[model samples]
Target chain A: MSEPRFALGQRVRIAARDVAVHHRVPAYAQGHVGTVERICGLYGQPETYIHGDGQPFTRLYRISLAQTDLWPDYSGSSRDRLDIEIFEHWLEASS
Target chain B: MSDHHDHDHARTFQPDHTEPTSDAALLGLALRELLISDGHYTAQEELRMMDAMQKASPHNGALLAARAWTDPDFKHRLLNDGANAIKEMGFNLLPIEFTVHENTDSTHNVIVCTLCSCYPRGLLGMSPAWYKSKNYRARVVREPRTVLKEFGVQLGNDVEVRVHDSTAELRYMVLPQRPRGTEGWSAEQLAAVVTRDALIGTQRDLDINAVAD
Candidate 1:
């Protein structure tokens, strides 16, 4: 299997296609910065939003992000963080 | 567990609009009982919780307002772990540990459960009539921008819309960002900024001007 899309502390951006309907991924941090907190098990390939066509995919990642980086004026403590599940396809290495 | 039935109100979800139904009310009551007996909530707290549900707008806003005013740490935590972090204020999760996703310009978050009304009832008292609507569940993913506009939440040309399909394992809620202009306010004052509609991401938090009116 190809290496996971992101590693711990690696910056990433959510893919444009995964921004469509019927997904579990949240919208706020689509192109946001989050560190790889944990590696969830492989759940087969990316889901085919196209009905009836299941394509083979790679592993997914559970990322953790600080709230400050998410909201521009966030004044909370440093410990505040949000965790989300992103498929390999949804993320791309940040510049 | 086998067949979920509600005598008070019918558990119907209509996206466009809803006519209050006794079945849904009954189902709400039954669900409340389930939470109470399961030790998730107490009788007295349930009454307040139900009242908060009925008084939806301002009552729901209380949590967000509080976060905006004093607990900067909490505001961040809530944005991070939407449901769990709210408990610090004594508001229990309606039942299950629901998923809460914050929506911002870079990204927009919308929620739907294709099969049924699987919401984070713990954080948000009861699913609103529109949330249960098939229109919302079916259309949000297909055409997010238009749907959000209908709800009065217009997205910027630069922002991307992300639809979330809620499931049995995970429920969804939204923590909107704090509005500016309320300087040096107490937590109580800040809590007032958050309305029930805001938590669901249907509306943004009320600003100082909106609060004045």
Candidate 2:
């Protein structure tokens, strides 16, 4: 509902706290920090998807997280990274 | 290294090979009957919808990939706005969002649906069973290089393996790099070499032999 709280190339962290809301952020990505890769257009909240006409559209973003940051003992190329789309509500500003 | 659920998937589902006689099936039938009787849709409309869904195939993605390889402008558009670009190619994508990930020499892209197997079904047809398997959904985001190896795609550290975890609203398809030895091949020939796995990122190197004379 609020204008996209984050901007392109901005650094942000996914909300580590578990909330009682239907969200798209993955569990593994929670609390991890990443760069905003792309500023995708907004869409309805997942909870309101079934009958979402007239519901406010929330800004969605594609965040790129380094593989090294995701796992403590990742056994793959350090160059590897994971990108996942998350709603603005589940993200917080991070240094 | 771990699973979200403690139980085995095999303990619950074997519905694929069996006929539907479960409560879920009855509920589905009831819903269908209600919709039809309530004039929401006729049985013919339902059949037509199913027919349209079945019409999806990897051939659609192949055509897109080949066209992108040949036409720079089309490729730019495809990478910028996937849904519109695909519609320009004569494919009416569903209302959901679509994004095309380009696999370059330095960066390899793989797609997975961590929550559920969300894919660009409109462009590339139904997802492969393995794409929907829990193992792939779990491992692809964690140790993608190892998973790629299992799928016969060996990537080096020089290339960044970018794993995309598709969400409910957004879906992804990878536009693999054009294979070598096709100096002046036609779009048709290039499409012939594009496989479903290639479009999904599991199969990167296109077999040049597929288009050989």
Candidate 3:
């Protein structure tokens, strides 16, 4: 197993994906840019690829977001903010 | 304006919105009555829970908020370890027992469970109805900003949202930030500023003139 390749304050973008059941990643965030604020310890490997009690994937990074970036026509106070958690594979370093 | 008046007349003539025919209301009433008969709780306790749900005021929360506003050290303690810290301020979080987690800029926290309304009943009293509904459990984690926006919270793109998996023993209560413009205010006045919404993180801490509103 390899250590997750993300850290706090790093810039990243969400990758596009589809699944039938619930997922921690939101659909709207696909391809959107965000900054990692904190690293939430870890979880096992992505269950999608792993099976039979295999080593779990490491989950990390709590990301802060702006309201306007997530939704269009959002005119709320600029100081207002949101935070969310994401896994390692869901993100790729922004160029 | 005639259309408005005619619409109002028709609405006034129709049955009241308070009609008690809804199955949920009937079921809730039945549950209350059964619980009372079974000695699970007195009518007064049940009423207290109802009143808290309606007005959502826990006098103890107000007191703690007031103290925290004035005392930096106490506020730090509460932020670090909420349960025991609140006890030092003279409030108890053990009616049914719960865990309180503070959400911050680095980490956001929302509480929910798909199974049942397992909440921190100790501090906030009983959980609100929406907390248990499938709508909240399903959407909060996936679309936190949208859900919070519906609740009148508008977070910026820079903030993060973290949804917690609340189970039997562990639950959550949101401790909002202390507002500005409350300089030199007494604990009583500060308590007046802290509303029930602040406890659940639905509303931000009260501004100086917020009490008037």
TM of each candidate vs. truth: 0.51, 0.89, 0.50
What are the per-residue Cα lDDT tens digits for candidate 3 across B5-66?
Answer: 24222222223445547899768656755666678877566556556555534555667767
Candidate 1 — which residues are off by over 4 angstroms? A1-95, B1-61, B205-207
Query: Against the true structure, whose lDDT is highest?
Result: 2
lDDT at residue B108 of model 1 (Cα atoms): 57
Worst 10 residues of 1 chain A by lDDT: A38-47
Model 2 chain B poorest 10 in a row by lDDT: B4-13
Q: What is the lDDT ranking, best to worst?
A: 2, 3, 1
Error of 3 at B20 (Å): 15
Model 2 C-alpha lDDT versus the unseen true structure: 0.84
Question: Residue A86 of candidate 2: its Cα lDDT?
Answer: 90
Q: List the pairs of residues colliding in candidate 2.
A: none
Native contacts present in each candidate (fraction) = 0.00, 0.82, 0.04
Best by TM-score: 2
Tell me the spans in candidate 2 whose CA falls farther than 4 Å from its real position. A50-54, B1-19
